[model samples]
Every structure is written in structure tokens, then in C-alpha cells.
Target: MIIEIIGIFFLLLLSAFFSSSETAITRISDVKIYQWGESKNRKYIKAKELMNSRERVIGILLLGNNIVNILASALATSILIGLFGDKGIIYATLIMTTLIFIFSEVLPKTYAIRESEKLILYASPFIKIFIFILSPINFLVQNLVSSILNITNKETKNNDWKQNLRGAILLANNKGDVRKPDRIMLESILDLHEVKVSEIMTHRKNIEGINISENIDLIIDLALKSRFTRLPLWKDNADNIIGTLHVKDLLRARNTNTNLLINDIMQKPQFISENTSLSEQLNNFKKDTVQMAFVIDEYGDLQGLISLEDILEEIVGEIFDEFDKQIAGPEILSDKSVVVDGAMTIRDLNRSMDWKLPDEEASTIAGLVIDIAQKLPSINETIKIDKFHFTVLERQRTRITKINIKLIVID
Candidate 1:
């Protein structure tokens, strides 16, 4: 009886060890394991190998854990039966259930989760050996499970790479391993593929350009006074962008010849579709070595202008220069109303003011108002959208210039 009881205790401890090891190893992030593995850490290498075939690892652990647990319970029942007869069976079941639940499942799992990295390093070698020894059983069990799932038409979800990466970044941030700005930048870069050029580009009306028909002296003066390094040169109107004139080119022209024409100094402007993804546009900017590109609609009308700086700002937040005018995001009026530039992007406004104004159908404040109103709104015309009211304060021709927004107070 003593020997049988000792054997049962040994089996139960083995079951608990396997249970804890499984949880610890699987919980360690693959990225961290791979990093350690690359440095030739034997424990991390073994852990990585085990995780490489996760189905096999999990199958082996489950098989071994169950075998030991069942053997321990059987031995306990037999030992107790000899001592107390029929009543021993009932006592054995109750005692084994409580012991297994507390020691094997809850206590070990809690400890493993708290010290996952350290526990994984210690347990991986033993787990790997167990996996190798149980290869045949693991393979059979995995195949059976796969077949069962297939027959039931239940497919396992593949890991989402972006979501995993995002989770890892957020974890790092929460742990204070990554600073807030770095975390935001990393997340913003991930968003580049989803965002469009038109969503962030400076609208056509806001673009600073010189008319090609203007005098060379006036063009030079405009270029010198302008904060932008590159200015668009348009023919007839702002929409007909001919080329981009660099301030450096103008300076070179001034040194070489007093009679500098806009055509002589302007570089051919690169044009991109307004709907182009920011990621693709960024690649194009690098490949072409172009800083600025004219954004056009499907019908070839100028929609806006996008630059390398603009794409970069999407990742690194706004970049401002000494000469760059500081356009305030949104201004608060005396009557508790907020005044915003019509060109302000809906995304920016929502982020700055903590408003839930929709940006799906329109990109800018003006576009959203015009889209909802179904026509150009006259100055001082108030329109209610959701919980907010917007009044057009100023208009440049057909375009909205400034808007006053007020949130409806719920009494």
C-alpha cells in the first residue's frame, strides 16, 4: 500500500509538471523565442523547434498529461480500496478531482503565467525530449484531430500577422518597454496601407502655386517668400498643374541668368491618383526620387498635392519648419462654438476635438458638410449633422473657407 501511494504521488507530480510546462512554453511569444534562439540559446532554440510544429507539441503534451493523471487516479483508487473497500472508490474520486484541479490545473498554470519566460527556458529541454519520444503518438493524435475538424467543416483560424504585430507592440507599450511616441509611430506605419493619399493631402485650394502666365520677377518673389521648398506652376488655373518649381532651381537661375522663365527652371511634376494607398505612394516617392506629386481624380482634375513630407508625417506626426506657418488645428469661439478651417481633414478634427464625426463618405470638414447638405451651402446657413451643428462662416467662390461648429448640449 505504501509503495502504491508513493507511485501515485510521483505520477501526479509528473502530470502537474507537464501541465505547467505546456502553458509556459506556449505562452512565450514566438518573436521573443526566435530572438533568443538566434543568439544560440539552447532552451529558446528547443522551445522554438517545439512551437514550429505547434499541433505536434500540443498533442504530445495532452497525451502525456492525460496518461499520467489517469494512472495516478487508478493507483490511488486501488490503494484506498484495500484500506476501506467500497467507500474508498468514492473518496478516491473526490480526493483526486480536488487535488488535480488545484495542483495540476490552477496552481501550476498561475505560477507558469507569472514566470513564463523563466519557466519556459527551464522546461523546454524536457518538453522537447518528451515530444521526440512521443512523436508516433503525437503524429497519430494530430492526424485524428485534423480529420475530425475537417469532417465537421471546422477550420482553425490562421494567425493574423498584422494583428499579432499590433498586439506585440501594444504589449511592449504596456510594459513600458516602448515609449508612447514610438508605439504611436509603429501603429501609424501599419495604417499606411489602409489610408489613401486624398485623406491626408493638402487640398487644391490650399496649394501655394504660381501661375505660369505671371511675370518672372513676381514668380521669383513668390518662391523666395514661400515657406515651401517646391511650388507648383500651373497653366490657366490651379488645376492645370504644369510642373513644380524648386526654390534651389530659382536661386540657380538667378545666379546664371537674369532672364529666367518659369519653363526653364520648372521640373516635370509627378502625378498620382488621389485614391493611391499611402504605402504605394511612399514607394513611388522613393523610387522616383520625387518630393512632391500632384494628386488627380479619375477624370484628371487636380484634387490635391501629396509630398514625401506628407507621407512621412503620417508615420512620424507633423513636421514643421521655421518658415512653415503654424495653422492652428481648431479654434474655440466666444459662444462655446469651435471654428475650423474647411480644409481640415475629418480624421484630424475627430482626433483633436474628440468628436465622432464620420470620415467615410468625405475627407474634409467642407466635403462632409457638402456631402450631407447635398449642395454648396450659403454663408451663415446652419446645418445639423448627428449631434453637432455647423455654420459656414466664409466661402471662397464655391469652396467653404471657414466653419463654426457647435455641439448640441443634451439637457
Candidate 2:
């Protein structure tokens, strides 16, 4: 009986180890492990290898876990049966259940959750050795699991590591491990490839450009007075972009070489399709030659301007400098009504105020209003869409320039 009891206790320790390691490994971050690998963080280097064969790692864990748990239960039952005869089955079951539940399952897993990174680092080398030794069994078990999934019409592969990463971030946020701004940035990074340049670009109407035909003094003044570091230079028409002039170059030309022509100082405009994804645009910007691109429609008509800063703003939210008075969002009045610039993107507004204004129909609040009304809204024209009310506070002949919006609860 004493020997059996000692064996049971030792098996319980093994069971606890397996249970905790299984939970920790599943929750560990592959990104963190690889980052540590880059710095030669020896403490977690083995975890990198374990993560390489995640499916196999899990198989070995379950195999070891089940073996230990069953041995412990069997040992407990035999010891109790020898002492209590026929009724020992119930007694053994209750005792083992309490002991296993408290010590082997919940308690260990709770510690694993709180210290997953540290635990995985320490345990990964041993886990890798176990996986290597039990490779044949792990392979067989994996094949059996796959066969069972197939038989039950279950999906074998999710393939969306991005969604899994997002879930991990969200889980961490809920646990207060990640702050809101950090969560936003992480989620935005995942959204970059899906978002298009047109959605975040400055509208052509709001773009400030100078005519290349303007006199040197006037051009220099415009460049200096302007808040933008880079300004588009056009020929006869605003749509006919000639090049982009940098304020630094203009100043350099003024001080050092006043003899330089506009053509000599300015860089050729980088034009991009309005439909180009932000990810592709960002890659384009990585080349040192281009800082901004003239966004054009399929017909080659100017639609807007997209800069590297614009793409970054999508990920990090609006970035402000001394020149940017209000980078994004609406002005909230004391009455709880918001006064918005018509050019404000629906996506930005939604994120700013936590509003559910749909961006699918139109990118901007003005475009949304026009789409909802089926006509160009006049000044002071009020339109109701869902629970929100939109009043066109100002308009030009061609576009809605400003709006006053309010949300009404219908109860």
C-alpha cells in the first residue's frame, strides 16, 4: 500500500507537469519566441524549435499526459481496493478526482496561464526530447486524429494564423496585458493589406498645390508658408501634376544656388492607382525616391494624394505635428452634436467615436449622405439614416463640405 501510494504521488507530479506544459505551449507566442531567437536569448531558444512542429508537440503532450493520469488513477484504485474491498471503487474515484482536479488540472493550468512564457522556455528542451523519442507514436496519433476529423466532416486546417494572432491579442487585451492603444496598433497592422489608398488619402479638393508657372519668389513663398514639407507642382491644370517640390530643396536653392530651376530642384511625381492596397503603397514608399504619390482613378484623373505618413496613420491612428491643428475626427459641441468636415473618412470617424457608421457605401460622411439621399444635399438639408441624423451645414456646388451630425436614441 505504501509503495502504491508513493507511485501515485510521483505519477500525479508528472501529470501536473504535462497538463501545465500543454496549456502553456498552446498559448505561447511564436512571434515572441522568434524575436528572442534573433537576439540569441538562450533562455527561450528551445521554444523556437518546439513551435516548429506545433501539431506534433501537442500530440506528444496529450500522449504523455494521458499515460501519467491513467497510471495514477489505476494505482490509486488498486491501493484503495486492497484496503476497502468491494466499496473501494467509489472511494478511490472520489479521492482521485479531488486530488487530480485540484493538483493536476486546475492548479497547474492556472500557474501555466500566468507564467506561460517563462514555463514554456524552461520546459521546451525536455518537451522536444520527448517529442523526438515518441515521434513514431506521435505520427500515428496525428494520423488517427486526422482520420477521425475527416470521418466526422470536421475541418483539419484553419490556415488563418492571422486570425489566431488577433485572437491572442484580444485575449491579452481582455486580461489587461495589452493597453487599448497597443491593441489598436496591433489590429491595424493586420488590416493594412486589406485597406486601399483611396480610403485614407487626402481628397483632391483639400490638396494644396502650386503652379510650376508661378514666379520663383511666389513659389518659394508658397512652399515656405505651406504646412506640408512636400507640395505637388502642377502645369496648366491641377490634375496635370508636373513634380513634387520639397521645402528643404527650395530653401537650399534659395540660400546656396538661386540659379536652379523648378525642374532642377523638384522631383518627378510618383503616381499610384487609387485602388492600390496600403500594403503595396507602403512597399512603394520604402524606395527613397518617393515620399508621396498622386492617387489617380482608372482613367488617370487625379483623385487624391497618398503619403507614407497617411499609410502609417492608418496603423497608428492620426499623427499630429505643429502644423496639424486637427488631424482627424469631429468637434463635439456641448449639446452632444458633432460638427464634421465632409471629407472625413467614415472609417476614421467610426474608430474615433466608436460609431457604427458603415464605410462600405461611401468612404466619407459626405459621400454617405449623398448616397443615402440619392442627390446632392443642399445647405441646412437634414437627412436621417438609421439612428443618426445628418444635417448638411455647408456645401459647395460640387460637394458637401461640412456637416452637423447627431445621434438620437429611439428607445
Candidate 2 residue lDDT tens string, 168-275:
888998999998788888888998888888888888988999999989999998888999999999999988998999999889888998676899989988999988
Task: Judge candidate 2 against the unseen true structure and give its global Cα lDDT, from 0 to 1.
Answer: 0.87
Candidate 1: tens digits of C-alpha lDDT, residues 1-411: 778878888887888888887787678776776687686767667767766776677778889999999999999898888889999999999999998999888998899989988887787778878888888987878888889999999967687879999998889989999987788788888989989998898889889999989888888899899988899998987789999999998999899998777788799999989889999999999899999999999999899999999889878876889887655579987888999999887866775665789988998899999999999999999999999999999999998989999999999
Query: Worst ten-residue run, lDDT, model 1?
Result: 346-355
Prediction 2 TM-score vs. true: 0.78
Could you give me the TM-score of model 1 versus the true structure? Answer: 0.84
Q: State residue 215's C-alpha deviation in candidate 2, in Å.
A: 6.9
Candidate 1 regions off by >4 Å?
A: 151-153, 171-182, 322-327, 330-342, 349-357, 369-411
Give candidate 2 misplaced runs (Cα > 4 Å): 36-47, 79-85, 121-136, 150-190, 206-236, 245-266, 286-288, 312-328, 333-337, 377-398, 401-411
In model 1, pairs of residues that clash are: none
User: All candidates' lDDT scores?
Assistant: 0.87, 0.87
